[model samples]
Target: MLPASTFVLGGAASGKSEWAEKFIESYDLPMIYLATGQIFDDEVAAKVAKHKNRRDGRWETIEEPLDLAPALASLSEKQAVLIDCATMWLTNHMMQDSDLSTEQDALIEALTACRAPWVIVSNEVGQGIVPENALARQFREAQGRLNIALAQQAGLVVQVVAGLPQSLKGRLP
Candidate 1:
């Protein structure tokens, strides 16, 4: 059985979202795709289109760059939601100079209180070489901390690599 909440982590271009989509599709629910990235450039737009094409008409798409907590809270418990990428959400917040701790608190709270079965995707950014720049280091640290917190609260935690999903905390659906 799928848990009330799941945390999916992977590196860039990994099959995290693909795995997530298939995982949730098994639940046989009309799922909501909460996209956090914006199409600000041609490259980004192309990527977004690819993802959209994958989900195509199967999901109710919600475009939210920031304020994930509020967007998540707005949905009914009956609506299954897959937050495609938390990295983007965090980046948006960071770009706006939002208080990270406070935003993370809100996110965790929302996830805990979410009545619907939900899944969130995030990048595992700390596994590679340390960044030389201070800002990059800070971002890496923040992402690591946030992922830890989310994993702790999640009913299931999975890390995908090379299109393979390795369950870290719970069984697959």
Candidate 2:
């Protein structure tokens, strides 16, 4: 059986989403792909397309960039959810000038109270050099804080480096 919640942390292109997808697919539950990324340009559109092409028809995809509470609350124990990224979710909120603390708290509560098992993908932004600009630095700090909160709420925390998962908290199921 899968844990109630899993946090998959990694750098860009580290295969965290692919690993998490396989992890949840192993349980054979109906899958819900909670996509948080939004495409603003052709490059981003292509990236999104690439991810979409990866999952077969076994997945039901939901595109909600700002509010996820409603989608998450609609889940049942017969299903499993993959929040394909917390980074994009955070970016969406930040772009709209939403209050970070309030939104973060709501997300955490929704994840923990969810009936279905969930795996959340997030970027580990603190390991790199400090961002030079104010906005970039702010985002980096917020992402770091969000990762910490997610790690605390998750039963299993895996850090992916070069596409390999290393358990930093609970054992992988």
Candidate 3:
């Protein structure tokens, strides 16, 4: 049987994505990489390419930048889906002036009823100093809230730092 949901959190360049990928790798099920970033420039494009290359043909990619719940709800249980990030997904909604509460509600509901095992990646942004601007502050707050919600959904929660994972919810199962 597939494993329950997982949440991996870390700071920038803290190996969050790599850690999440490794966690998903341990599962023998077909892999699915649910990407949330939108490539707006050459740098972003290069980063996306690097991630694709690192995945090494093991994962089926689903690029969903704005809508994640529907895509998650549509996955097959045979696939272990890795959402390599919540931050970008949140930014996409914030940029569009979408209601965060509704989006988060849908995400939580979908997460509870997803058709497959899910490994979710998200940045730990509240550990740093407070933001200067109002919008930035709001974003941080929203991210914190989302993390908490995701943690509750996940049977396993881990914080990755310098390529090391510290399990928050349960030991590596």
Candidate 4:
């Protein structure tokens, strides 16, 4: 069967990444951990380090805080890539005032063109209270729109709540 692309959605600290990791481990292939968070402070750095410590060294780790399209396009068909989180990737792009439409288009194209399976983890940001600031509101709106688009293209979409996963689109492995 052809490899599938999955989108895992959840709130912060909702265990989406953990769930995605378990799913990737089941494939028994050369795994790739695509981390999109850039450590801007000690707290963020520690969190990133924790994630790295949890993964098996056998998996190749790619840290692309922004411009993930090129990195995704370079992978081989024998690999299974797990993007730890898309929220941070979006944050990285937005912080730099990057071209949102162009970046997202590139990302979607790269994901569709990937030869191997991929598990993408992202935050479900639309369920919370509305942001007080304009920038924060814009970010939430953009994230929500991006999630909707990704879900539509994904072969499988899973949602996590309080560490519990519920398959929303396709069958679970």
Candidate 5:
């Protein structure tokens, strides 16, 4: 059976989101795609378009770059939500100068409280060399912390690399 939640972690373009989508689809539940990416340039817009094209009528996409509480709260146990992903969500909050600790705590609480099963995708940003800029370094640190918390809360944790998934904490359902 699918667990309450699964944390999918990987580097950029590591096929994490695609793996998560398939994981959620296996359960045959109504799918809710909670998108956190915000388009500020042509590149991002094109990327978002690609993701949209990947989904069919089975998905109900919710575009909320910040504040996922409302959409998460509206889900039921009969549904499954894919929050693809945490990196962009963290970026949005960081750009707004939000309190990282407070926001992270709230997000964890909300995810735990959510009634539906979920697959949350996040980037493994700490694998690369240290960034030179302070902002980049700060983002890497924050993402690492968030990923840790998510892994701890999740019943299953998988790390994707080169389009392959390796289970970390629990067996893949």
Candidate 6:
């Protein structure tokens, strides 16, 4: 397998996104930022804006809340793609009652087939207490399963904690 597929997983406020951003910056190729967030309120909008500002304006922005496979497929070998937080995308799919299995299959297929490097960021939501509601529990379980699947496919897997990155599977670039 090519060394282009990397997975970054961490808890909330764990600096995973920043780490991924810096890693992508090291590569001198054109970047595509695949944002999975939807601005539903001021707080979310502010958070999204902060991320946007962190990125160089030269990077192409693609706000895809779901259906990321097609976007990934459109990328070329010379471009690098940074998927900011797959957790939000999963949440969006869960909220819409979308089929998780189908989406995951499509994502894995795209990731495996893509020639360009992909830095996928996702929150590790299974480290905390058990959720109270059924929906929350389901989401947590789905996220865990998704992370596991992605990690298996990834050539490298890094878990960020307290702004420090711990390489779990492969060497850090």
Better candidate by TM-score, 2 or 4: 2
Query: Model 1 misses residue 128 by how many Å?
Result: 0.6
User: Which pairs clash in model 1?
Assistant: none
Question: Which segments of model 2 are wrong by more than 4 Å?
Answer: none
* Model 2 residue 102 distance off true place after TM-score fit, in angstroms: 0.4
Q: Given candidate 3, what's the lDDT at residue 150?
A: 93
Error of 6 at 120 (Å): 0.2
Error of 3 at 48 (Å): 1.3
Error in Å for residue 43 of model 4: 0.7
Q: Lowest summed-lDDT stretch of 10 residues in model 1? A: 69-78
lDDT digits (tens) for residues 60-140 of candidate 6: 999999989889989998999999878999999988889999988888898988878999999998878999999999999
Candidate 2 lDDT, tens digit per residue, 1-173? 56889999999999998999888898699999999999999999999999889899999999999899999999998999999899999999999999999999999989978999899999999988988899999999999999999999999999999989999999977
Candidate 3 lDDT over 1-173, as tens digits, reads 33578999999999989878878988888899999999999998998898888887778899999888788888888878999889999999999999999999988888888888999999999999999999999999999999999999888899999999999887776
lDDT values for all models? 0.89, 0.94, 0.89, 0.88, 0.94, 0.90
* Candidate 1 local Cα displacement, residue 157, angstroms: 0.4
Stretches of candidate 5 off by over 4 Å are none
**TM-score, every prediction:** 0.96, 0.98, 0.95, 0.96, 0.98, 0.96
Mind giving the per-residue lDDT tens digits that candidate 5 earns over 35-84?
99999999999999998998999999999998998899999999999998
Off by over 4 Å in 6: none
Provide the RMSD of all predictions against the true structure, rounded to 1 decimal: 1.0, 0.7, 1.3, 1.3, 0.6, 1.5
Candidate 5 residue 173 C-alpha distance from true site, Å: 1.9
Candidate 6: the clashing residue pairs are none
lDDT of 6 at 91: 91
lDDT at 59 for candidate 3?
83
The positional error of residue 142 in candidate 4, measured at the CA in angstroms, is 0.5
Give the deviation of candidate 1 from the true structure as CA RMSD: 1.0
